[model samples]
Target: MLPEFPMSRQCPYHPPAGYEELRKEGPLAQVRLYDGRTAWAVTGYDETRRLLVDPRLSSDRSRPDFPVLVPRMAAAKLVALVGMDPPEHDVQRRMLIPSFTVKRVNSLRPAIRRIVVERIEALTADGRRAADLVPEFALPVPSTVICELLGVPYGDHEFFEEQTRRMLMATSTAQEAAAASAALIRYFEELIETKLGEPGEGLLDELITERLGRGELTREEVASIAMFLLVAGHETTANMIGLSILTLLEHPGRLARLRSDEGLAAGAVEELLRFLSVADELQRVAAADIEIGGRLIREGDAVYLPNAAANRSPEAFPDPDVLDLERGTRHHLAFGYGVHQCIGQNLARAELEIALYELAVRLPELSLAEPVSQLGTKPGGSVQGILRLPVRW
Candidate 1:
């Protein structure tokens, strides 16, 4: 029998234990999914990157053969951008690219810095020596930045955050995930309607006036896009911030280096992204038969590209297991590869760089309040992150 897919990580900082065995098998290995179906698990770095850009692979989550590692992910098919393929995906991605371009993200650096500083002040206020970084700092910094950019009211963050958490939880039942998704869709639908009536400077308002008013896109499509941005924009970055902090704390020497040198922050953030690989895996389906990695992928076959495994592949990086802040290479698939690569990567990079740097400089004495083993993680979730990072300075 083939090894089951999505083997659990024995350590949160490492890839799933089964991934090593799968890698040893070959770059492309078959694994069984939850529904007793077998799919190709692309564990090699070069093979994963090549497969990501291949036109023969489709990202259509609605397809019957699309490999969902967990059942709850089936409810995410409604996400207009990530679940789309070819002409449709290209069109939707184009509509939102202007907002997330490098120039645009660079312009937001001052604002991001301001948000990070404010969060740090709040975290250290009242002479507090200990706090949960997830809620106080890690979550709020990205949450506020994305909220301001997307025109979503930061006040309602708790509501949408809860809904998103439910929808993304791997253990959620199909019905439960569907319900949570519905609630988010409804919320975005109402928000989009309001934006249509009264526009603002945020990206959502711009989309409404430019695309929706021109009849180029439907209101539902707009809502789905907003929902996708709202969820993706914050959740992944927030998790990265928390985990990056923990990783740095474990390596006091590197943490001290980052604290003393502002220039090292950018490279450190890139290394952290490569090391963490917060998002579990990229999913796709074979659009046609393709031969690569010494194996033939039949048409309609499901493929799982585990980012953690690919980032840690020995062929890709020297001493792949060691976290070197000076890795200096941004060639990893933390934001994925190809046309479907993360649209918001620029923004995420800015947030991570700003948050980690500011935290290191502002609170140089920061350390984990609780033991690493005692920290909790999101249970069986597709995204790997600490549920709560108790820390002190």
Candidate 2:
């Protein structure tokens, strides 16, 4: 029998066990999803990379045959840039490039550094035995940064974060997901309207003053993009921050080595991304018939490109399961590859580098407060991470 799609991970730090068998099956294998639909699971590194950039594959979720990873995705309208192709995708992506440029992201380094420091200070300030790192540090740094960047009040984070959680949770019901989506859309609409005349210092304000104000894009488009930024910017990094710390804590000698040599922060960040690959899979649909490794994927066939499977492939990385900070090769699909690669990766990298380095320096004695088996794992989500990470110095 084919393995169930979105197979559960045996452990938080490991890929789903079924992925190992799928990789051995060949570059491509079939999988059955909860909806009783079968999709082609691309398990090989080379094939997954090739198909990610293939024009014959479509990211458009509107297609009736498009693979829906979660209920929220299935309920979503094909309105966001993620669901666009070619000219439309290119145009929308270009508008947001200015905010995500290497220079622009690098310029925020000091702010990110400050954010990390402040979070660490707060975490260590309270005279308590231990604290949940997820709430204490991980969730706040990115949430505050993105909020300040987008001109959204940090006070509203609870409303949006809860909604985003509902929308992304794999177990979310259709009604719950739809309501969350509706709430976010409504919030963005009101926020965008407020920014029209009196622009703020955030990205949304810039979009309003420069693009929307000049009629370059519709109000709906600007709001949609802002909503996308809110969810994508904070949630992924927040999860990574919490989970990466847990992974590092599991390897104490490595953690000590990193603390001793601060220069390893960048390499460690990349290594963590390659090893964990929080965004486990990239979903697509074959736009046209394409032959891959002796298997022909028919048009409209759903394709599941799991990054965890490829990142852990022996063909791609020797001792793939081991996390080596000095692993010379940094080519991993953590943020994905091709034209659709993550736009905020530079920013995410900066945050991780700063957070991990300073955490080690500030709390060198940091250890897991809870047993490894006791750590709470968020069971079903496109992004795999811990719900709460308890730690002590």
Best-fitting candidate, scored by lDDT: 1
lDDT (Cα, tens digit) per residue for candidate 2, span 284-360: 88889999977999998888899989999889999999999989677888888888898889889988999999998
Candidate 1: lDDT of 313? 92
Candidate 2 vs. true structure, TM-score = 0.97
**Clashing residue pairs in candidate 2, if any?**
none
RMSD (Cα, Å) for all candidates, in order, is 1.1, 1.3
107-159 in candidate 1: lDDT tens per residue? 99999999999999998899988899999989889999999999899999999
lDDT, candidate 1, equals 0.89
TM-scores of the candidates are 0.98, 0.97
Clashing pairs in 1: none
Task: Report every candidate's CA lDDT.
Answer: 0.89, 0.85
Quote the positional error of residue 8 for candidate 2 in Å: 1.2
